[model samples]
Target: MKTESQLNIIFVPYLSPGHLNPMIDTARLFARHGVSVTIITTPANASTFQKAIDTDMNCGYNIRTQLVPFPTAQLGLPDGAENLKDGTSPEMLGKISYGMSMLKDPIELLFHDLQPDCLVTDLLYPWTVESAAKLGIPRLYYFSSSYFASCARHFIHEHKPHERLVSDTQKFSIPGLPHDIEMTTLQLEQWVRTKDEITDFMNAAYESESRSYGSLYNSFHELERDYEHLYKSTKGIKCWSVGPASSWANKSNEEKANRGHKEELAQEPQWLNWLNSKQNESVLYVNFGSLTRLSHAQIVEIAHGLENSGHSFIWVVRKKDENENGDRFLQEFEQRIKESNKGCIIWNWAPQLQILEHPATGGIVTHCGWNSILESVCAGLPMVTWPMFAEQFYNEKLLVDVLKIGVSVGAKENKFWASEGVDAVVGREKVSKAVVELMGKEESSEMRMRVRKLGDASKKSIDEGGTSYNNLMHLLDELKSLKASKALEKTNLKI
Candidate 1:
């Protein structure tokens, strides 16, 4: 191999936690392998993952953060409110999307100075493909989702089956996918249907992905063999499948050193202690994820539903949704649960990984975010899917219809916090039944076994000589080969 300096790669992430956190872990993985990595973010969003990045810094990794200001004032958003979580309506969320485009200049300037060997950016930043071209470096699209969802979207995009349907409710076969998947027009996320700015931006994003060097997925071949191959054949873009990357990077070495580290370990959340006392596979864990906001009525139904199911549970309730009706219902329920020791409620945040790994935790009632799906699968727990909005509905379909590892609460409406009011309320009866069936039935045991096999595969993929590990090694070797050729060409030009 021709002599060359170490390769440097820059990772640029979107503002949401779900998108940003996984990319951070991917960056850390690169650093661990002796690549210099820089993560691009707005100062406000940087704080979200900086602590984890700092941990690697302390551990002697070459990961660093580079900041580009999020255009808060230009978008008329309040100072420091740059992320999707801070937006209360679609209008403001739109502005946040607009702000991302304005970041192109600052990012391009940084690229000139760093002259990285490659650029890896989230799918939203369509401009990065050109940014990489300007510096004569390669760019790769980073999809912070499953290959199943991306493949589904690609088929829908090409076929336009939703366009010819009689009504939004009519179900049509997703054309050109390996699996026989059926989906209704309404289940498609809002962005796919419209002719608006967001739609235009995404169209451009897909175009950029098609033109880029390749795409990177946070998934592995063992988990989605057919879809991964289908994605490559359909898109014609080279891909690298190195994942369960989130858990692989974030898994605590300290805990691994003591695999038997009990729930009562020093500084463990008190919730874990409560979980440890419960019988094996006897508790239901519920959370709507970080960005979703439920109406007071919806919240009340879920509260009563969990109570009616008569199963032990721990629910993570958002502090933002509490009201007189919901607060009153939860308070009354909490007292009864305390007396009976049937449940626990955490008002804002819960330590998700620890709880999911606990032996007492049985099933999850989830928002079906891709990150959450991977985490749950890695824990070998089946889910009760309640998809709120965005691509989550598609994710739910993957779980309930394709994988058969989940039961649906049948999300009747796609409500985002960016909307004015609730679209539909899944009543207590439906919620209760789904929870009961998931936790108390033989089918649930079968699903748990199915998911546990996937979980084992997930763990193996990142281990030495596994599919994901080998893919990662091949990727690095190719990049090194490319670097050697570039260095030799420069030397010849000088001569």
Candidate 2:
């Protein structure tokens, strides 16, 4: 184990809102618990951090942020670089390499100057781990993902190296993963295939994780008990599940629009007003998360599916092109919606947290990213999971099969590569049936109650004396112990 030291914890993330949000919240929680924390992010994200700091400052937190220089290649990324139209594994590898190379020196200098007792960072950026090791800081991986997703990523790293590319048969079932959880080749990211770069990156990723001697996952152990054993046994690092972290991080003051960029970027009231008119558990909030995009055909298919389902819904469609004719497709969609006399509220820019928090939100049609999953769970809503790529398939499996908290879609066919922007079509009949089952059926109602109970437990865990809260305290004390040990070591060395 790394020796005790005063925890001057430094956290860094690869550029993305999803990665940045939870991490910033965790930092705040640490600061609240009396750990001196500094967040290193790009200038692009500094504003978001500033708002959060202001909010915390008002509530009396000392969490600080420093805008590190962004690597030149990272500066001009499209709105969603992770979901780029021309994304390839090789290209992503080069981008990550370049980003790390740019971030390392500045980060190392800061590590030396700040002299943090420990370092916590996102799993994707291996360079941070290398930097932490060089500085002799105890590094912890804060995976902003479910236990299932983490397990799958680990499985992908351990096996599938020589295979180069994942075949459909190859992902059927792994020896180490949970039963009935299917991971297909198409759902696997390109990072899984590149032998040299991916392996090297993953080795560093694991090494950093190993050095941490512990991890903080954004999930509860009860929800993932089966997989938790494997997680513990494999890494040999203490795993602390402290989530639905997103909800714990939520400011709860919808009135305070000054805390984050989401407030400026979205109109929370518009979503809430529509929800107010709807019945309890009557509306389904549809979104594919920030990183997933749909093609025209898939969009039409989803439109028709919602229309046929005869349910009211608030659909969030994030387009790369929000030009004058941005919502040109809505004209056709409205006609179909009018025929059914069902409600369809389309927002290119939707207030996700506010919408999820609304009482009318009974179900979520989601991309099963960890944040979206945690948000849905916190909202006490069930999911109609449409996992796109990467570790989402694993998250989807946990939701639908293991936890029975959501309905699963998107793995039966390989529509991801069929065309650009085209979602794998789950035709109107299947979509209608699934929604009907999720919204009106007895089975669906039971699942709704199940997730509600889970939500309550999540809240309890993060509240005073709850599992998550207690875990956070333990982690803080652990850092303190390290701090004391370091002081003692220096004293003995002088003797």
Best by lDDT: 1
lDDT of 1 at 147: 84
- Best by the TM-score measure: 1
Give the residue spans of candidate 2 off by over 4 A: 1-6, 72-97, 156-171, 193-200, 255-268, 321-326, 334-341, 412-418, 421-423
Model 1 residue runs over 4 Å out of place are 1-4, 73-79, 253-268, 418-423
Backbone clash count, each prediction separately: 0, 9
State the weakest 10-residue window (summed lDDT) of model 1.
255-264
lDDT of 1 at 174: 88
**Native-referenced Cα lDDT, model 1:** 0.82
Residues 1-495 of candidate 1 have per-residue lDDT tens digits of 111477788999888878886787788888888788898889888776666777788988888999998889877999878778777666888898778778888988999988899999999888889888888878989998878888888878888999998988888998887668887877787788766876887789778889898888888887788889888888888899888876788788343222211232346656767888899999999998888887777877888899899999999987767668777877887888878888998876666777788899998999989888988998889999999877888788788877889999977555565233455788899999999889985758889889999999999999989898888788877777887788889999999
How large an RMSD does model 1 have?
Answer: 3.5
Model 1's number of clashes is 0
Residue range 144-200, candidate 2, lDDT tens digits: 887777777777667753255346445555447757565666666656643468657
lDDT of 2: 0.70
